[model samples]
Target: MAVNRDKKEPVIEVQDICKTYFMPGGMSQSVLKHVSFDVMPGEFVAIMGHSGSGKSTLMNILGCLDRPTSGVYKLAGKSVSDKTDAELAEIRGREIGFVFQNFNLLMKRTIADNVSLPLIYQGVSEAERHERAVQMLHKVQLNGYEDRLPTQISGGMQQRVAIARALINNPKIIFADEPTGNLDSKTSDEIMDLFTALNKQGITIVLVTHEDDVADYAERMIKIGDGRKVYDGLRAEYQKDEE
Candidate 1:
């Protein structure tokens, strides 16, 4: 389904966002420079940049993992730019889901345990956590493998477990950073297909990748260069305009 940009309010609003890191000797390096954009509900957006282009920094700000040095960031319409670390953690728990490139799972833990890990922080009971984990595994097509350890699964299946874990919180938005970085081409395609299915179900996805093929999965693209936004529009149109 197409996103209606006019009628519904954006799920993410970033205005003139900027980030800088200060060195010990009063030296500083600016990362993102006055970047801004909005992502409507259910929109599949990809953020792209080469290394040192600040895409990861942008993702950190959007995911509430880090605060911007300056500028406004609103998630679900409320400004989160000034929220405290604790407040941001709460918001992240309640509103954002993250899937990392490394598939950050506990090696010794069972698949179900890993998927249910997020709920432990929310004070959810063990029984319910297992139940929800099973449900999420089923959603990711990993139903019967819940008892297996992460070491027992293929790289692709492990990523599925990561996706299941991300879904356990029923987040308003999902941030997938280089989600297919370790997978083979076929597995990457499968994972992107899953993301596409989820987006069709009205889940907002913000993906960050440097690969053109990976970025192609998203309907819209936001490209950054030298800490500045160089492009924002339909993914297909970006190169066409450059050409």
Candidate 2:
């Protein structure tokens, strides 16, 4: 259909993406069926859906962790399907920052060390990595907490450190999969506020959350059901309709 094509070159472009997994007896299960979407530059968007709606599968494909069975995926206007694993890793390392609900920090490392992981992978010098990580911690308002272990900090602070780690790479876009899934109510608000602040500074963010209130924080919301995009629009318009 005409909806599959757009005049503008989206920062992320996916068309007719279908993903299937092989089952025990050679049967295949389709996780994403003809999923297609576009993400523009500097956009703050949230994806919401139920457990079996294929949102996670779409996220994996969008993040380049998995490939689609029959479709095209473009990142930064370049075709992802043609890239090798090393090339994909290079693209992800240099352009995408990821935040997860678990905070995924290394308990054995200090906060500074935890934040420096990506830079280390990029072959940055130790001194430069620590310096950049420290600056990022300061940006997230965790300046002096660098020496502390994640266990020593509050849940909110741990998430803040994770946010800092995600930003340390100065990525083109940040992908947050259920960023506040494990946080308490108050902590969730704080995380949302952090995202707001980051967005104000021009960081593109793609968030996935099932909670409507959480999704409202994003500029745009997309709802998926039965492997199809059921709703896509500005959050304010969606809220107005609900009222």
The TM-scores of all predictions, comma-separated, are: 0.95, 0.92
Off by over 4 Å in 2: 1-8, 239-243
Q: Candidate 1 residues 1-243, lDDT tens each?
A: 997757888999999999999999999999999999999999999998888899889999999999999999999999998889999999999998899999999999999999999999989999999999999999999999999999999999999999999999998799999999999989999999999988998889999998889999999999999999999999988773462
- Least accurate 10 contiguous residues by lDDT in model 2: 234-243
Model 1 alpha-carbon drift over 4 Å, by segment: 1-6, 240-243
Q: In order, what lDDT does every prediction score?
A: 0.93, 0.87
Error of 1 at 187 (Å): 0.5
Question: Cα deviation in Å at residue 203, candidate 1?
Answer: 0.6
Root-mean-square deviation (CA) per prediction: 3.1, 4.5
Error of 2 at 63 (Å): 1.1
